[model samples]
Structure formats: structure tokens, C-alpha cells
Target: MTRISHITATAYSCPFDKQHQLAFGLGSNVKRDVVLVRVTSEEGLVGYGESHHGQHPTAMAEIIERGLAPLLIDCDPLDNEGIWERINRQQLVTHGLGAASMMALSGIDMALWDLKGKLLDQPIYRLLGGTRKKTRAYAGGLALGFLPPDTLQAEVADLLQQGYTAIKMRVGDTPARDAMRVGHIRQTFGDDLDIAVDAATRYSLGDIPEVIRYCEDNRVYWLEEPFTPDNLEAYAELRKRTAIPIAAGENHYGRYAFRSLFEARAISICQADLSKSGGFTELKKIADMASAFHIAMAPHTSHSVLSAAGNAHLLAAIPHGILFEADVAKVNPFRTELAQPPFGVVDGHIEPPHGPGLGIQIDETMLERYPAIAGPCYLPIERSAGPTG
Candidate 1:
């Protein structure tokens, strides 16, 4: 049995060619952060994966370099689930389930899966029983925000021209503006198109009802993270206000927290990020829970290719999988260069990686090209007002 020979986590920051000015949530993404973890087998095989940096890439990398790597070094890489349990029982217990710890473990879990697929000489999807070759995907653009109505309409039109049947646009710029954008898009495009609005935790307690009414009247596919996951009570109440699917989970870390979300009955769709949630190990348990509850799933993908490929494999294997989020940003090196072949959306759907492992080969040059940029990449809090639970 080959044991994990070496493990290291490196942080990278890729600045967008132009800053992404969002109406809310991380208000303007000037740069994207990702902490990549590499695990080497005793035989010299290597695998790569990424962790959601949460605007703190350096800190997340320290957890892997100083905390998680030790637990994994001598362990068998193929005991995928067993290694996950060991990490949970050891490091996670000692560190507590904080964002950095969870994100760090997620990176490790993903690397092990990539290594496993390589070991088995099969792609991750094929190893997971190969649910489907391609899964339906929607354009996920951070640029679609509280811009002018013409700008917003033009953005939608351009995406549709690109063959995207569905798209997600940012809301929470005030209920009136959000409502008008949704209504205009629906009126212009008609019912055949799918439109999802992500509030990005920019709404007040009072804003919930107005947004709900708008979604109900206009047919918004899902109101994503209308409020932060911390406000479970608000989410439960908001669920009663509308029939449009309430989607969340990218912020949620593990299955224990998801159990609470399921109990709350607040979310109709669970949108976990593989690199943030718990990678394949814990995600399988979460997906199983969603299946039992009949809740649909839509995995969130930012700019990390590792997370994107990991998400595609999970989406393909699960029965409840609906769609995967694909970043449509103009400049995203993490999405383009982190993986050798990168990810592509063909015919409005993404074809699963056919390569062994995450179906991605880690490009070492990204380490030199992107490096780490300092300061917060998310929106400044003072710039954001209204209730934040």
C-alpha cells in the first residue's frame, strides 16, 4: 500500500484584468484567491486540489502546511474515506470546525480523490459509476449586478447568444432594482429561459418579503443565500413567503451543519462548493442526505479549476444533481490555468473530465505566475449596509 509521501499547500491570487464590480457580496472582486494542496504518493504520483480561500488564502495554506499535512504524510492515500475520518477525528477536533480548518481539510480530501482516480487508471466519474457524460450548466457571472437596465439586458442577451439556456445574475441592490431587472429579463426573453438570482447576503429582514413577492410574480429559479446561513430563523420564515426555490450551502461547511439546514426546511436546493464543504468524503454524505429529502442540488463553483472539476464528478454521480455553476468571468487564471486542459462548456452543458483523476493535470507554472496578493478580495463591510444576521 502506497502511503502519502509528501503534502504541501500553496496560495495563489489572480487579479482580474478589470475588477468585477458586484452590486453586493464581495462587492468588487479585484482578485481571486485559492489555496492549492498537492499530495504525492510513495511511488511519486502526484495529485492537486484547491480550497476556498475565503479571502484568507495565506491562513488557509498555513493550516494545511502546519496542521493537515502531518496527519496525511504517512497515511494511505487510497483509504479515501478512512483518511477523511482520521483527519476529522484528529485535526478537525483539535482545531474546531472553523472556516480555515474545513477549507483545509476539503483541499486534502480532493487531492486524495484525484490520486485515487489516477491509481485506479480511470477518470473520477467512471470510478463513481459514471452517471452522465455531460451535465446541464448555467452561466454564473459576477458582472451581472445593479448595472443599468440596458447593461443588464445586454449582458443577458450576450450570454444567450453564447448558447447558455440558463444564467444566474446578482440581486440584493435594493428590492425595487432587483425586481425590475428580473421582470424585464423575463418579459424580454419569455418563459423558455431559466433565470436565477443570487442575493449574496445583501438583504434586510424586511427586504425578504418584497424579494419573495417579486420572485413569485416573475418566476426566479432560486433565491440564493438571500440571507447568510447564520440566520436560520429568517430563512425558515422566508421559505414560507414564496414558492421560488431557496438555495444555499456554499457557505455551509459540513454534513452536521447541513443536517440543521435540512431540519429547518429552509432550502429547497443545496448548493455546496466541493472545495469548501468537505470534498468528496463529506460531500457524499451531504448528497446522500439531500437525496433522502428530495431536495435538488446545484454545486457552486468559483474560479478554481480543481473545485470545478471536483464538482463535475460529484454532479455526475448523484441522482439529485440539477446543474453546475460555471464561472463566466472575463479573466480567471485559477479557472483557466490551474488545470491543464481547463474546463469547457459545450452545447450549454459541461462534459466531465475524461482524464484519470479530477480529469485535470495541475500546471506547476501557476505557482510562479499568480503567487499570493495581500489584502481582502471581498467587498468592504462598511460599503455594505442593511441587516446582517
Candidate 2:
């Protein structure tokens, strides 16, 4: 049995091609943020994973380094379940931890799964019991938003040309503004494209009625995160307001968090992030829970190959996986630069990366070219001014 020898985390960021904007409180995104983790086995096998660093790159690096790394040394890399429980018991249940701890554990858990795949000489999906080798995908660029209608249309056209049958656009502007953007998608493609909208949890119950109406009227596939994950009542009410499926879970922490959503019948689809929802262990539990409730699985893509490959593995294994999100950024250095052969789409589907593990190797030195910026993410609400600005 290969024992875990060491753990390390690195943070990176690159300025976007052009600044991007979000609705609700999020103002603009100046850079792409990422934090990556590496787990090494005593036999010298190395596996990589990506944490949710769009929000806290430096802090996540620190937590994984100081808080989690010490606990991982000498643990069996194959003891994924046991290590997960230990991390959960220590960082989650014991400390009453929240997002940071969960996010850090999520990355480490993925590293272990990757390490397992390497040790067994199998792809992570196969290790996860997958029958399929490829998974359906959708374009999920951070670029599409309530930008000028023509700008958004150009972004949509390119993705369509790339053979994506489905795509997601960001929302959360004034209802009428959001309607115009979503309405353009319907009119531009007529029925050729499947469109979904992510509100980024930017709306109140009052702000969402019109948004819900727009989604329904325009055949929006689903409305994602119209309310925060913690707001179950609002999510349940939002579901009742429209026939379109309600999707969330990226912001949700664990299977326990997802259970509350299930109990409320708040979400029609579960959009768990393998890295953010407690990696493979917790996500499998969440997927099973979603399956029992007849909910679809549409994973949220983190902006790196490590998480992207991880998402694909889980998507291929699960019975309920409906869609895999891919950031359609034509020039995303983050995705292409990290993995040996970065995950790519062919005819609107992603073949699970071929390798013993995630099929990705973190360019640890890439951290130097794109060091983490120290501050809150630029996404804002009410934009009165915050650390991001």
C-alpha cells in the first residue's frame, strides 16, 4: 500500500483577456483565480486536484498547507474514505468549520482519488465505477453575461460553432435587462440551442419573479442559484414559481447541505462540484441522494483542468449526470497550461482524460507566472465598494 508522503498547495491567477462583470453585487472579475493541490505517495506517485479558488486562493493554500497537510502525512493514499472522515471530523464537525475548511478538504480528497487511480493504473472514472468513457458537455464560459446583446451573441455564436448544443449565461441584472439578454438567445438561435441561466444567488424573492417568468417564457433550461444555498424557503418558493428546473449545489458544502435542499424539494437538478462538494466521496453520496429524488446531475466546472477532469470522471460514473460544464474561454491559460493534455470538447462531449489518475500534472512552477492576488474576489453585490474593487 502506498502511503501519503506529502501534501502541497499553490495559488495562481491571470488577468482576464478583458475585465468581466456579474450581476447582483458582483461588479467585475479582473483575473482568473485558482488554487491547486498535490498529494505524493511514498512510492513517488503524484496526483493533483484543484480547489475552489475563484473566491480564496491564498487562504485556501494556507489552510491546506498548515491545517491539512500535517494530518495527511503517512496516511494511506488508498484510504480515501478514512482520510475524508478524519478531515471532516477535524475541520468540519469538530471545529464547526465552514467554506474554507470544506474547500480545502475537497481538494485533498480529489488528490487521493487521483492518487488511487494512478496506483491502480486506471482512469479516475473507472476507479469510480464508470461504464461510460465520455460525458455530454455544455459551454459555461465566465464570458456570457448581461453584457451588450451583440457581445453576448458573438460569444454564443462561437460556442455554437464549436459544436456545443448547450450553454449557460450569467444573469442577475434588473429583471428587464436579464430578460433582454435571455430573450436574445432564444431569438438568435430560435430552437437550435439549449440555454441555461446562472443568477449567482443575486436575487431576493421579490427580484426573482420576473426572472422566473423570463426563464419560463423563453424556455430557459434551468435557473441556477437564484437564491443562496442557505435560503431553502426562497429556493422552494422559486421552484413553485416556474416550470423550469432549479439547479444549485456548487456553493453547497457537503452531502448534508444537499440533504436540506432535497428535503425542501428546492432544486430540480443537483449541480455539485467534485472539488467543492467534498470530492468523490461526498459527491457520490450527494449524487445518490439526488438519484433517489429523481434529480439530474449537472456539475459546476472549476476553472482548471484538475477540477474539470475530476468533474468528467464523476459525470461518467453517475446515472443521473445530465450535463458537464466547460468554460468556453478561447484563451484560458488556466485550463490549457496545467494538464498535460488539457481537457477538451469534441462534438459537444468530453472524453474522460486518459491517465492513471486525473491525467493532469500541476505545473507547480506555473504558480510563479501567475501568483495569487491577495483580496476578496471582485464579484460583488450592491457594489457600494469592497476589497475587490
lDDT per residue as tens, model 2, 1-389: 67889999988888754444333325666677888888999978888887887477898899999998898799988988899998888888877447788889999998888888889899888888885467778988565865678888888888888889998888776677788888988898987689988888888988876887888889998888888778999988877877898999989989888989898999999998877889888898899999999999998888788778888888888888988898876556778887655567789998787777887666665567887886655655453211211
TM-score of 1: 0.94
- For residues 154-210, what per-residue lDDT tens digits would candidate 1 score against the true structure? 888988888889988888777877788788889989998999999888787888778
TM-score against truth, every candidate? 0.94, 0.94
**Candidate 1 all-Cα RMSD:** 2.8
Worst 10 residues of 1 by lDDT: 380-389
Q: Please give the CA lDDT of all the candidate structures.
A: 0.82, 0.81
Give the clashing pairs for model 1: 26-379
**Runs in model 2 lying further than 4 Å from the true structure:** 17-25, 379-389
